[model samples]
Target chain A: MATAAYRDIAIHLGVDAGSELPAQLGYAAALAAGCEAHLCGLFNRPCLPMIRHYIPPEVIERHKAECERAAVKARQLFDAAAQAEGIATEWYDMPGSALETVLVQARASDLLLLSGVVPGDKTARDYDRETLADEVVLALGRPILLLPGAPKPGLPKTILIGWNGSREAARAVHDAMPLLQRATQVTILCVDPEGQRGLPGAELARHLSRQDVAAELLVHAGRDRDAGSILLQTAQDRKADLLVMGAYGHGRIRETVLGGATAYMLGKMELPVLFSH
Target chain B: MSYRDIVVHLTLDPRNAARIQLAIGMARRFGARVSGLYTVPPPNVPYYMGEYIPTELIQKQMDEAQTASVSAHTEFMATCASAGIEHRWLSSELAPVEALRLTVRASDIAIVGQPDPNPADPASVPYGTDVLPHELALQAGRPVLAVPHSGSVTEIGRRILVAWNGKREATRALHDAMPLLRSAESVHLVTVGPERKGRTLLAEITEHMQRHGLRLETAIVDPAGQKVGMALMAEAQARQADMVVMGAFGHSRLREMVFGGVTETILSSMSLPVLLSN
Candidate 1:
């Protein structure tokens, strides 16, 4: 078996006064150390909308000062974390919308890491966490690891892959190969609808085996609406530290309406979830 | 990740030998097994005349198909045995399109032939089989390597040219070709489009590939009024790339068929082997 390594990893840093910046940097640094890769931290300093007529000058100055302060804090945290982990690191203090800045910077790395978004979490931009993850996954064409609020600084030991036999799922699996290869146990969880044809996850099992990844398959008959909860429960039961899945959406790229399972997972992600679109 | 199982679609065309040889070489490189799939289009009879067909005629058609499959199989076996590679032989009774769809499930990558529009030997590639490559690439859920009908491919994955447009399909093709690109001597990432601002995606990709230890020579080519596909092929030729790795189609098949897309142009007029994943 040829073990693959991710030599370049990027992390999305939300330049806010006080947030989960340290924890996010800590987890990302740990991963970069494990893979011996260069870690690039992208700090998004939100720029105010160019509507001077509507906004007052003092308000704009206040916002700019706040952004500058947060950017400094973010860089300090990132440098300290990377130094502690003793990994190669780079930092970019970009001035723009959080989503656009992160998307552009993320294209230069194999894997991306970010603290899971939540409502009222004081992120740099005024976008929801789910929206941030979805936009980057769909537009950037890279695998993103959404870390929980305060994740332990290390890689996953037991990984769970949500398989549905779609193109998105396949892409997620391949993108997560580096993590999968390093894990001690891997399980392919297939939640099939009432009466679908030929074993849902049997082919994926064989496919992974061919790549020298021996995976255990667990299938359950359930409705599509319950897939998200079922996968979460399975990961918890198996003690999986990482959840790998496809980010599904339909319609226009920008205005994508996520599928049920994808939406549910994004809203209620527990462990570190690696999502690829 | 490396391919563990490879399937080569075998037709009666003498070029079948080239496809098999390429597969064998790849199998040797990856330490994998090869499966030769032999399929022919159903006897060309009108669908409305289904039940009225005579038994002898059907029998005769079936026999000819069997004979073609047998000869192809014999050659496949001989080639693999001489190469001393682990291999399998499969002949499907199902429709060519359907058979390939099912067979590709067990394989990581599929090797198919570019349909010869004006085949010198009609028996080699019948009229209906020209669509198999496109069909398999789109529907197989696996990467397809389409070998040109007239190329003598002495080397594959040596000097490679990748068409990058920052689309979903292009991303898939790039990652799918990683295993091959890892061993290639040179890789050129060419983007065919007009100059535009905020296109830092290419620079980011360059940094990404550098992390993978692949030094990519990137170029931005303006189509300058030429078709995107034509410009891409011209770039490939100018670079003297032995193989072209690209995303199959950015547009839907129906839309591409009607409006003419890059995938169609490349499929219709490829001078070298191309690897595509939709």
Candidate 2:
């Protein structure tokens, strides 16, 4: 079983200032962390040149004031959310690029909180937001909690482990230990096993036992199915609300060649999966 | 390309049987050939006698290992043939990565099993050394598809997630993934962090893909108050993406920033399979 690297959960609240998702996710983090959640707010400062361009030369003296005013408003909103959750809150104002600044701060936090920004079109510009999120994940080396719209009432109860005997799987299991320990039922499913000797599920079961987390291991031997399809089926059969496993395989150069199981699950599995590399 | 000619690498340990079967199934799907390579320990000499092991003795052991490898490959190919796929087998003493790399060099792809699930346990041997998929990826110079020791999969490539950052690595990944992206029903270009001014790199990628007739959607996220890695995971879930494509970011020896903050975050905490290019 793995523990999250960080104890603090940092929520990146967009400059929109009024979005409800940030607060909702904040409350969820508070509940998940119990005593460990540290809620913080970050404001995206416009680049100095952008600010200069937007404001007239005569009003340049007020530029600093305008930035401060926005920061103050963001702080107030973040403070309000923290107060509502009855947790301590911190605030910071970032300059230059929002993603870069947020990433820098994320280095010190345990988990990152974000709100999904839907692309208005399929064009390149629309991909900016998605690219930024992916970049943060690829660049930061931490886990993120995305607030789709609103936060759910509780953490996942039924958990699924995508048992692959890979370093990534081991790391994912370790990362997910915190959540797995609290889940009501845990299932470790191995998709294909015509001749394999050992399964990851058994190891997970043992790890859970040490932690006193109850879990069950299931080995599904599918002769011809892809690993991903098998995992999705097992998750569905087990009624798992969350899936835990290692993010499988990669291609040589750039393309991600998902191990059959991971690729399939990503495509069709609706259950939430906790993954780590 | 169809999987018919793909050669998959198999670990010597019997524990990878499940993964091998899954690989055979994939090969079948693509009408590909299947080959199993068994890696053996490097030969050692006895110090007392100051003599090398006899060639006959080595041959006998090699023969036995080859028999087992053939048996496994044959059984797997039987399954594939039954499913109407053409398949074959190859056995060699090369390291698992080297053997598989050679087999697949002129072929289509290589599928390697993940190491044992419990890496902490010393006895497991985690795919017997030569099968470290990451190491293979670094050296293969060809595409390597990694399969988890468990889990079943048949078809691949559907909803694709492109982890776009305006970087050379990201662009390389996009270029490598053209085949999958071209066939994908929907492609999501996910960007993180704060807003950027002027023409963004992600936009350029989107335009390029659009020119290729790919159906795509773009998303932006701010890991405000949260770790960037976690935020991307959340977004990947929200998009319901099957696979993520990005550049393998790391700094050169002299460059301390190696794998910037976001790249490091995603690699350590990635929930989805990320394709990375250096």
| Best model per TM-score | 1
The models' CA-based lDDT, in order, is 0.77, 0.55
lDDT of 1 by residue, A110-173 (tens): 7888666443354454345546776778666678887756666798889999887766677678
Error of 1 at A215 (Å): 1.3
Candidate 2 chain B: worst 10 consecutive residues by lDDT?
A: B197-206
TM-score of each: 0.86, 0.45
Residue A24 alpha-carbon offset, candidate 1, angstroms: 2.0
Compute the interface RMSD for each candidate structure. Answer: 3.0, 16.9
Over 4 Å off in model 2, which ranges? A1-6, A16-23, A32-35, A46-77, A117-126, A193-200, A219-241, A245-275, B1-41, B45-53, B56-278
Task: Report model 2's TM-score to 2 decimal places.
Answer: 0.45
Pairing residues by index, what is the TM-score of model 1?
0.86
Residue-level lDDT of model 1, residues B206-250, one tens digit each, is 777877778898999888898888899999999999999987764
lDDT for residue A275 in candidate 2, whole number 0-100: 44
**lDDT tens readout by residue for model 2, B1-278:** 12234556654456446555655655544444565555554433345545656897767756766675666766666766775655555666666666654444334345665454445555446234533554554444334555544445444567777766554445445544555676677888777766462125455345445545566788788878886557776887787776666655444543216435555565445544455443
